[model samples]
Target: MNADEVLAIYNDLAAENVPVWIDGGWCVDALLGKQTREHADLDIAVAREHAERLRELFARWGYQPQPRQDATDWNYVVATGSGSTVDVHVFEFDDEGNNTYGIEYPKDSLTGTGVIAGRKVRCIAAEWMFRFKTAYTPQDKDLEDVRALGERYGFKVPATHRRPAPRL
Candidate 1:
């Protein structure tokens, strides 16, 4: 997803008062306040209470549910006929900031603020974003993302992910 499409969805959702926090690759770019690469989908974290309303809005915008192998009731993707997609991650946070449902995003992980296309946006915190990207067996894109975050946030990129993605 490009910045314009991502922003359009974010603004529309804001218009409806359904809050969301950007995650994944877009979150990296958001935290950096600029686009670094092309994205296949926009990932967002929403309160479980608003998940249904989020879906309703997408339906009105012509987006349909797109099934994936990892699909779950709280985590799934929706796509438009034009192929733009949003990967929705729903979470229920407890009074103490623990995640009680859906993705295990830490209490402070969603506290980040970023700029996309000059408009400030909520996103995963920089430190948490770095940790999440490196926690997995990274793809080429993940490594690049981690590297960028490292450079920007002063974190050391782990040796395991220091190797560059192989060139075909």
Candidate 2:
């Protein structure tokens, strides 16, 4: 999704009192304070308590749920008629701060605040993004994202992700 669409959704959800945290590649761009590439879809993390509200919002916007091989009740995707999609990750935390359900998102990982299109937005923290980017075998975009984060914030990137230059 493009920034305007993403922001519109964010604003709409906010108006309904459903908080959403931007995640994945769009999040990287949020942290970078600009859009680095075209985003195919938006990734968002919301509290489990808000999933129903989120679903209703999506339904109202003509976003149909897309079946997925790995979708759990707490995580799934919805796509609009225009091909804009959103990957929704629902999460919960215990009183002691442990992840109790859905994605294993630590509370601190959500502390990041960044700007998108000149508006402040909540996103996954850079350190957590760095760890997530390096946690698995990365695609070229992931490598580029990690390298960009490393270059911008002085995070330690794995040796393999230190690309010599961008691929043509």
Q: How far is candidate 2 from the true structure (C-alpha RMSD, Å)?
A: 1.9
lDDT of 2 at 62: 95
Q: For each candidate, give its TM-score against the true structure.
A: 0.95, 0.95
RMSD of each: 2.2, 1.9
**Stretches of candidate 1 exceeding 4 Å from the true structure:** 164-168
lDDT (10s digit) by residue, model 2, range 1-168? 889998999999999999999999999999999999888999999999999999999999999999899988888999988899999999999899899999999899999988789988999999998888899988889988998999889998998777776679
lDDT of 1 by residue, 1-168 (tens): 899999999999999999999999999999999999999999999999999999999999999999789999789999999999999999998898888999999988989999999999999999999999999898989888998999999999998888756899
Computed on alpha carbons, the lDDT of every model, listed in order, comes to: 0.94, 0.92
Instruction: Itemize residue pairs with steric clashes in candidate 2.
Output: none
